[model samples]
Target: MNDLFAPRIAADPSGWNPHLAAVLADLATTDAVIAAQLSKWAHGWGAPFSLGSVPLSAVYATHVAPWNPPEVTLMTAKTILWIATVDDWAERDDAAPRGLDHLQEVAEGKAPDPHSALAGALADIRDTVLGAASSRRRGSLWVKATTALLAGMKFEHVASAQIRDGGPPPALPLYLHHAGQTIGVPLTMATLWASAPQPACDSSLARLQPPLESASQAIRMANDLQSYERERRTGDLNAIALGASPAYLRTQIADQVRHCLEQLRPLLTHPCPDAQALHYCLHFVLRLHQAGDAGHLHEREQQQQEH
Candidate 1:
């Protein structure tokens, strides 16, 4: 699991930005320097499993604000990098090793390690994207949204511990409720924070909480579908880990999609930046999953070798 990471839904080439790729290529030296200072890397970038997947930061920014200028593209990518970096290290145990301890400290407003490059990157991302007025308005909400995945990860940790001790995995109904957040709900909303600085973006997030949950659930289920066999073999938590009905997961995913569209359609008529960003997220992810999630390119590589 060290080699793998989350937000693996952006594998579709339709979301690829060749010029952006070139820009990232051009900035390779700069990224290398930053990576050196941080001493950490992200999937789809400098990490071990980056072969076929670009960092979520790059690919997700392209999908979120493709119309933005290059500068915004880079800024959003950095924020996404920060998200994935913290996510990568949040694990406490090797079996489903993701927790909220470090992020919890941040959520409580404790400064990260003073010399850590991740802290610097996070500050740069926030200062670059969040303006004074918008920051003031969105501070609490940002904290709330940023740590949204904590509970889900903590639950998984406990569940993993129980399973490790020969206890049963969590029940299907209970697991389904928190499953969506297992991969970090904030990733879905990071694009909103990346969106143009508008005070409306703050309230826009509040209004869209329902749809955001739906989107998270939908994405997690898509992951379940794609990683079911891998998870079954590895004894990881999965919707159908106990051999539950894939058809049931499909039906729930469809329901979530409907809920997202139904709730988002009304917001689209208005000019809410966060709503627009979420709309893009839901649309892109649904299309990607419907077509099939291919972001775990390393998995494909392993499969080919096995064959």
Candidate 2:
């Protein structure tokens, strides 16, 4: 992992923004809340494999903070845990399509098996997260984002199967487009919107289109860089496995990060505080992923401690 992303990681402390540092610190303080939520969910769902591997503190610090309302932080934390657990499971298991189908059914408002712990837990998360939306439009947006994430998961399952069957890696453009959705950026954005100070209209969100795409691409590249080795060993389809050299992948990731930051700069000056907060939150997560937490979960606790 270091060999693939050393250059990108080495340039990071300088790229860190001070304004977001305070927000991140505040987020880190939510560790107790996130941990409590995770503990409760673990007791009910039997603990995801990631419970021991990925620090809940680090996840909330990167994914749920800055925009999370104090009242709903616990719900947000649970949602993040659900997303991470489902994502890890899908990536590691060959039978993921079955699980994805179950989750999609639950997300679509189908009654999950009352006896199935995983299905029940997923339904609870879907309801609680989407239920917090202030308006039907925002709720629908959250549902749409979740649907897109599931679609991306199915696409990844197909790509992973192709790789295992000795087919070529997915085309670069195809990977990036699908990876953006698979990485959960859209869902995260929907969460941000749902928790924003005011309802975001289509036009307001449209203004953020460029930065959002840049952020998604940056996240995809960072994830690919950090996961290349493990993904290769696991027969997963990664951007790096598409025959790109380490140096070239590093350059591409750097370029994406720069573009993401550039696109976000103007949004920082937007009249809406939600728009500005969204920009900061997006940058915060991208920086965390670029710093290697997205794939290298073992280091997350240490990194957060140092921060």
Candidate 3:
């Protein structure tokens, strides 16, 4: 096994945020600097392998929320682990190499091969974040399998083995679960830290901060969706009060159309490749969100004319 493939232990037990304020302070002064830092680190981590396929940007965007499916929780944890590993190295001004060249260099550092080295790093990250215990191994396995695929690795045999052995899914780590509760805080702080205080370009960098701009948008959309759902329930209740006739069923269907729009608007706000990819995967949901509104309006017109 290559030294690079060896799972060296990383020290982040407390997972402290002491550097947050400093990062934000620096970013308030410079706009492109943090992005530059990320790019640099990506280079050092080595040639873009399948692991680079993990959508760090989307992870940053939505991973902070409570995931109904616990797999999402693990996915976020693994992605953050990768980011933490590379980000510190990326921040240095002296790191000259950029893009694919830098990644290739980093990948070539291993004795055996780049692919296996990356696989080991990924496996190490899973063990680190999930904890090292026999009880947790199953959960760790699931995360490792999913993360490897996301990063662009193929481990079909391992994945099939996991499915065969699976019974109940494991609980996500406590920190990752809580990370959703405090969703926008780190991202907001990070953006603030990385940006210059003054406007870096013609426009204010502060204005474009993802946390500042999108968090509120996300919250509002979430709220609107909730309200839409409540109203639909209320409409159903009213229909039941009137009696569940053909008209009542049609009314409930119309309600669904409006509810779908509320859901889709938030998703479209700041879409990236990962988000778009996920959206495509949820084609049925997307179709409902897109077509639902027009259908609702038409139904409303028909209902009004009949009345």
lDDT of 3 by residue, 272-294 (tens): 32223222322322222333321
TM-score against truth, every candidate? 0.72, 0.78, 0.23
Compose the digit string of candidate 2's lDDT tens values, residues 158-225.
Answer: 88888778776688788778888887666766765664446544446666667667767766777787
Better lDDT candidate (1, 3) = 1
Global lDDT of each candidate: 0.59, 0.67, 0.32
Best by TM-score: 2
Candidate 3 residue runs with Cα over 4 Å from true position? 1-40, 49-63, 66-117, 132-138, 144-307
User: Which portions of model 1 show Cα errors greater than 4 Å?
Assistant: 1-56, 69-72, 82-99, 114-135, 201-203, 290-294
**Candidate 1 lDDT over residue span 1-307, tens digit each:** 1111134444668789898788757555444443333333343234322222334345665676544555555655555556545544443445333225554555546666554444544444445444432565455555555555556666766786678799988888678676766554454365345435666656566668789888888778877887787666655678887556788777877788788878898888977767777777766555555544335555667788999
Q: After superposition, how far is residue 156 of candidate 2 from its true place, in Å?
A: 1.3
Worst 10 residues of 2 by lDDT: 1-10
Q: Please report how far candidate 2 places residue 302 from its true position, in Å.
A: 12
- Candidate 1 residue 192 Cα shift, in angstroms, is 2.7
Looking at model 3, report the run of 10 residues with the lowest lDDT sum.
Answer: 193-202
